[model samples]
Target: METPPKTDIAAALNRVLLTRKERLRSKNHWAGLAKIPTTTVLDAFKGSNSTIDTLTKLAEGAGMTLAELLAHGDPDWEVQVKIRNTFRSWTIEDVDGLIRLLERRSGPRDSDAS
Candidate 1:
């Protein structure tokens, strides 16, 4: 299957901020959290194999919560389609709600914690 649209997937994963630079507010925020030089973070929105920790810091520095970071957006990635012989169910709607609910439940991350 074709990969989802880059924007769609990126937004869903909360990495859109890195690409758009909206997730970062100031140089000092990253400096205080990540040991990496401020320039490095700026250069690498595309951090290879980087974990959520880095993403969290980026979001925090930008004053956004992790859940805010990971939101798949209003279109909703969980809004998928399933077909059966004769019965039809709105699984996508339910799934989308669940994902959004989960996102809301996840609070912000600590800047100091390891």
Candidate 2:
């Protein structure tokens, strides 16, 4: 799948779960995933203080589609994934949503860690 543009990442997620509460309650949710919530992940983006491997693990655990998390939850689910390509140092293939998130967060342009 071709990777969607980066901008739509967050928007797709908004359309998806509506709130952190719902994402938490998802069928795929697991204790490993819940250990860190979306808000926590979002906040970590602010300072590049988070780890990518951790995020990917969470994403997989939560059953979040990869394309959804990678584009920051962009509208397009298609992924032209240059699998294992790290952006802004956010690449951790083994992990779940963690790598892509960290990549965006570490960058100066996407430091919206709120």
Winning model by lDDT: 1
Query: Over the stretch 1-114, how does candidate 1's per-residue lDDT look in tens digits?
Result: 996544332343334444335433344455455555566465444334445676576556545455554543325523321122112444787779978888788866578998
Query: Which regions in candidate 2 have their CA more than 4 angstroms from the true location?
Result: 1-4, 7-9, 19-32, 37-39, 42-50, 77-114
**What tens-digit string does per-residue lDDT give for candidate 2 at 1-114?**
997455443353343334344555542343336476656555443434445665565456546655435544444333422332344346456465876788788876645657
As for model 1, its CA RMSD to the true structure in angstroms is 16.6
C-alpha RMSD values across all candidates: 16.6, 15.9
TM-score of each: 0.33, 0.33
Which residues of candidate 1, in runs, are more than 4 Å off? Answer: 1-36, 39-44, 72-114
Model 2 reaches what TM-score against the true structure?
Answer: 0.33
Query: Model 1 shows how many backbone clashes?
Result: 0
Shift of residue 77 alpha carbon in model 1, Å: 8.6
Cα lDDT of all candidates, in order?
A: 0.49, 0.48
Worst 10 residues of 2 by lDDT: 76-85
User: Given candidate 2, what's the lDDT at residue 21?
Assistant: 45
Question: Residue 26 error for model 1, in Å?
Answer: 7.4
> Which residue pairs clash within candidate 1?
none
